[model samples]
Target: MENNMFCFQCEQTLGGKGCTRHGICGKSPEVAGLQDLLIHMLRGVGFYGQKALEKGRKIDQDTNKFVIDAIFSTLTNVNFDPERFVQYIEKAAEIKAYMKELAGEIDGVIPAAAEYTPPMTREEMLKEAKKFGVMADTSLNEDIRSLRELLTYGMKGMGAYGHHAHILGRMDDTVSHFFYKGLAATIDNSLSVDDLVKLNMEFGQVNFKCMELLDRANTETYGHPVPTEVLITKKKGPFIVVSGHDLKDLKQLLEQTEGKGINIYTHGEMLPTHAYPELKKYPHLVGNFGGAWQDQQKEFDGLPGAILMTTNCLQKPRDSYKDRIFTSSIVGFPDTAHIKEIDGIKDFSPIIEKALELGGWQEDEEDQKILVGFGHNTVLGVADKVIDAVKSGAIRHFFLIGGCDGAKPGRNYYTEFAEKAPEDTIILTLACGKFRFNKKEFGTIGELPRLLDMGQCNDAYSAIKVAVALSEAFECSVNELPLSLILSWYEQKAVCILLTLLSLGIKNIHLGPSLPAFVSPNVLQVLVDNFNITPISNVEADMSAILEAAATA
Candidate 1:
């Protein structure tokens, strides 16, 4: 049978392979096709945008922001509305036309992506979209397609980080320019495997810079995150549960709902907001609501409060709570209320009103608190103590085990891995994947907690910073510092973070629940040979291997 759509960008793609008919994340084939067309349109914009940059002509920040947002919208579980993608396609065409005019004369052969025009109607758009899907080019080499998709997915993750920084009034020219360069490279047939590999590495470096820029934007704007304990139990009253990774949206919602009798509870990545001094000051900002994004349908069923999804990690809403869910920023779902910014400010009044009408829970749940807010600033602040513990053999090893979580089986490996880790080891975790064992009791080593909760996935910046600091203090390279990265990947953000680690020459990283389907055997071999990246094994064997390796080292 012929396939209707093709997507394998996320870790949970159907059968450890491509999702041909529909997405495992609940996106319909029509939405998948539209997302493909949207990506295709962005590449067209990138062609002209790259040419404009070569001619020393400036691409406006508006165009840069649009490209970043459009790319971000294509990441797993971000936007699922076909109509919204149609609008983005239209806008991308306009941006491409403007860029073409600005780029002036072309010096060499033009790629087909640069010359293609989007169709007019939704029906025509869907038909045209099918031809531009990932499987569109049958003649392209499989390895080349693998590398191209790898680079593109990395850029998609970089775009998510860039968008977060952009929202906070931060911009980096190097990061912005690479988006155009990398996007155009995907279509440049003259580039060989080695050339694409080099580009992928180059993207890695740029993505590190992007992640760093976002780190600064978050820390500088909100004041560096400090250690704070957050309440996980819900309270009685009108409340709104904010999900995703947008701190600015959370800050705005906190401000708008102040003293309005509506409490705000964070869900998913937003759980770290409690550590930011500026955001946590609001009395109405209460506690965290649910676990990871994968459990939303079960956790949110018949929820009393409203839900505001600021960015990605949005599953299709269940009928139980669909009416009360609100989407902001680039997140969109059909038949949901959307909050748009006016004058660079989001009005969450719709969500606020929805919560007021729902009236929240009747009685407060029993209080349960968990530790968070151990960002780079907090961890590095006590660097001397950590170093001292390592020297004293109180902390024998460090395990960095975290990434995107999913509903797939074998994820219990992380829980058991962390559980079986020796008492002398420290587990540094971040991202939604930590939800698996964040609530577990891992006893402290001296004054330090055995498990540290870093910030959101973008806060991989924090983990990297802490590692570099440790390496410097111990007088060893990061890879030789008795640390191991066992990551659980789900989407494009994880792809870029993994690239950033590989670009830094870090080795012996373990990845699962399953390897990305888009990574061909040759590309996978390149990673294994160059970086020693390995697929995760069973918890007992992997743990014993890591411990033995550390003991010998």
Candidate 2:
């Protein structure tokens, strides 16, 4: 095993370089090594499966779900279980063998262009991984390296959304086809920087499809989000805090715990769950428990309830709550008990018993309230009012301050940016990033709320829908509308969403808390020149610049 790991996929990458010692997200070098091997085997499966597809053999549904989970598992802060990766590698190898059989039925077996070969044992895979980590694939052409990394990161984000949707009985073959295409592209170094950049843009298109699929799954299952006020304070009685963006788990928890004298509350991206009509109908679904995922350690500390993590942005557990933390789906922490589902039946009794034993706060100690659930349907419901407001000069500019919220430095800029927006401007925010300022009062502009909280990060598709509809209403390009996208990036989801925006030719996107470490100078220059992307600086300064630009346009 290597002494250090190299990962630069998220906002907290070390010094805008790679994390060469331990992961900023709490993954060890050994865990990172296994993830590399997992990806290597997946690409091999992709190469063979893709060839089989070309010969008219359809990949099975189980293989599609397996590939989605396998890619998403390697995302930052998602899975830290080395043994879990070992299992995923073994499963991927089995798929590779199946793919080989399928390929054999075709024109004969085609050799893998890359040096990696499927390992028979976990130990062999771990050893071979050392020679094939992200660092080992490093190219002297920084621009090419950067583009390749962008494609891989975007796929991880796409896989996360795909995995969630798959779990809920929805899967798209188009998404699966490109999943293999993107993975296969990662191992092809003969492709030039230009070739990789072109593929990176395609990642945006595929990611949009994946996001759209997840959006359909969520809206159809949970009902489209509407304006609703959620309690920021905890309520009395025993409760369970459900975090991450998995609504299916939340639904099941609410079902299993109904009338059992336990309360359920949303945390982080789960906060918007309050707006869904189906989930909101449950009487025991209480208020939110904390701020963003980054502050969970302090917010969760000493809180007398069980916390269930359904997805990523999971930090290392604090000693105070580590014992009570529960994981489901692809999320894993070494010693914590995981709630597993067998054939759609997830047993959550451990979480229920934990809450019952610990109990929650004695009484409601806080009274803060935040408004959310302004999904595209809700926003477009009042499109005429919004259009009239802009036409009547009641709304001057629209600033979109959204993306993942992280514990890293300079994230405070988002809080300040939202705080300093002019009274007439409508701030549209989504994802975990909304936690930065959701608790604060921005007041309303006429009939509209000053800040609109569209669902989770996947809800960026809703934002795009609203944006495109607004463009059609005004008879202008989306960029020509009175809008600006000031976004913050943390994980691969943001990467895929950014690429989607670029694919749409939406320009002048202000991106921060910092530019991606994977994007080299030359590649960034291309991004700036093509997309007119700007890095965020002082809030007041960036705000002034965007406002002035909007006015001049």
- Which candidate gets the maximum TM-score versus the true structure? 1
How well is each residue in 444-501 modelled by candidate 2, as lDDT tens digits?
A: 9997989999989999999999999999999999999999999999999999999999
lDDT of 1 at 486: 93
Per-residue CA lDDT of candidate 1, range 272-305, in tens?
Answer: 8899998988878888988999999999999999
Listed in order, each prediction's TM-score against the native is 0.99, 0.97
Q: Indicate the worst ten consecutive residues by lDDT in candidate 2.
A: 106-115
Runs in model 1 with CA error above 4 Å? 1-3
Please report the TM-score between candidate 1 and the true structure.
Answer: 0.99
